[model samples]
Target: MHFSRVPVRTLDTDEKSVAQFGTEKMLESAVLLADSDLDAVVTLSEEITKATGLPCSTSTLAQVEVLKKYGVKRLSLTGPYVDGPMRGLVAFYQGLGYEVLKTSQMNERNNVVFGNTPLVRIKELIREADHPDAECIVVACTNWPAALVVQEMEAELGKPIYDSVCVTLWKALGMVGVGIPLFGWGGLLQDDPILKKMEDVLEILLTCCAASRTTLRLDFLQKNCHVDTVCAEACAAGIAQLKQILVQNDLANTDIPPPKALMDVYAVRAQMLAPLVRGDEIYGWISVHQVGKTRVWTEDEIGELREAVERVNGILRTAGWI
Candidate 1:
């Protein structure tokens, strides 16, 4: 829940320098927070696209998540970038399947000028960026002082105003299951019953993933190679398949179909395993089981298992484990 900001030592207006600075700062922040007691980190710059190998926008993926969370499809953007970086920003949003209705960029791209630009000027820019079909307006730079006026402007404009800094904060808080409804930050910061439930489910799954990883590692040390865990069972079957299930447990065979043996020992009837993957690299697998009689695996269960694995993958990325 604690935050520490480390300013990247580079001019915000210099696109190349800003990209490099963002990459370094992201790594720097991850390393710093990873060693501390903090559970997560949120990199504020949406302009830092180089590290993730994303086209155009650096923060587009995270922003897209924000958009998806709020069900916003079309966007109007106002930022302090010059023409060169501005094009990249627009392309980034377009690449993510969001319709960019209108955009306004300030002629002055100086770092100090952008950071110090008057709120009145930004209000005008927001108006210029507004469009009839746009669902939201994004103040697309972290350094630009937008948070001070976001909620107020949104009230006047009758549309959501998403400041990059606010979005980053909202996203970071959401990921950790802190759904506090803070006023003066626009609709994204408000409480959503659906999003809260989703966050609660995600937090539970993340906890399960961490506990599973820990249990597997501990069992690996205890068993001394040939880790007889749920994932190991799944790996024995096949990594390509999403899940491996043994519904009815027969306790006669303990060696073959290790999952069954493990299930038999625990008196479990059904087991399912999903691969934990980062890009194409398969780190390990995850599993779920039922202790009672045979149970049919539904499509929703399978989908949720996959989502749990992906959530674990996300945690791994944030922790620099992948």
Candidate 2:
């Protein structure tokens, strides 16, 4: 909850001097942090760790961890950074094998100017950097107050947004094993634990049903119905066909005739889908698939799937995600 500022004379300073300044500041703060008896220390910049050889969590590391957790390989980046730092950020992600679909920067080198940038302008920059193929958008610069706009932008864009300040706190909390359910900042802070529990439920359902695959599709924060978690093998084509059938059947729980193309292309023989409904609204559905050969769904299997749906709905309700 406490912050210590390390004043950099200029962001455009030579790299060596900047690194030296970071190292000195980290060394000075390490003593204070250790004396304060904090559970963990989170640095806003990765340079502190690189310069001081400290074992603290950092924003850069947290952002990468979150991207990996979300299975994001392609991203669009926006920040209040000049060309040099912007290119370096792009290269850093590229070195990690992530595809940088687009990048936008404010070209501002002054730290104060970066902090004083308007929130509306930051949102505009993020939107400009976004691409249809990009899995997520990254808002860099811990000083820019990007955290305040992450939730609003994610809802507007229908994709996750990772901001530096939020991710740094996320990493720090996780390191200390604090399971605080957070909301409103971004999906990383809000939905990570919920998603983890949903995935666990899918694994249990997969084992209990003795099926080839089990998937949990939910209408997440943006009300977009997508596969949120899967257990065992997943067939994209099979899931797509199942979705079509569900739409055609009016979201009812039924064993519809499998389309010939589905069988021919993906070898999906049978599927049992139960809609996750709480009263009038149909949030999404849980599906169990039988591949390679046709098998009639037993009453017990259908019953198990229905129970799983109820469990998922309970989770969604408990997390206030419904």
- The models' CA-based lDDT, in order, is 0.58, 0.71
| Segments in model 2 whose C-alpha atoms lie over 4 Å from true places | 13-21, 44-55, 192-322
Per-residue lDDT tens digits for candidate 2, residues 157-257, read: 87888999988888887878765546557667755556668767777777777776777666553533344423112322223322212311211233466
Residues 78-156 of candidate 1 have per-residue lDDT tens digits of 8987776778788888888888999998966566677899999888899999998999998888778988888667757
Q: Tell me, what's the RMSD of every candidate?
A: 17.7, 11.1
| Most accurate candidate by TM-score | 2
Clashing pairs in 1: 48-58, 49-58
User: What lDDT is obtained when candidate 2 is compared to the true structure?
Assistant: 0.71
The C-alpha TM-scores of every prediction are: 0.52, 0.60
Q: Give the backbone clash total of model 1.
A: 2
Q: Judge candidate 1 at residue 218 and give its lDDT.
A: 10
TM-score, predicted candidate 1 vs. hidden true structure? 0.52
Off by over 4 Å in 1: 1-19, 22-25, 44-59, 194-322
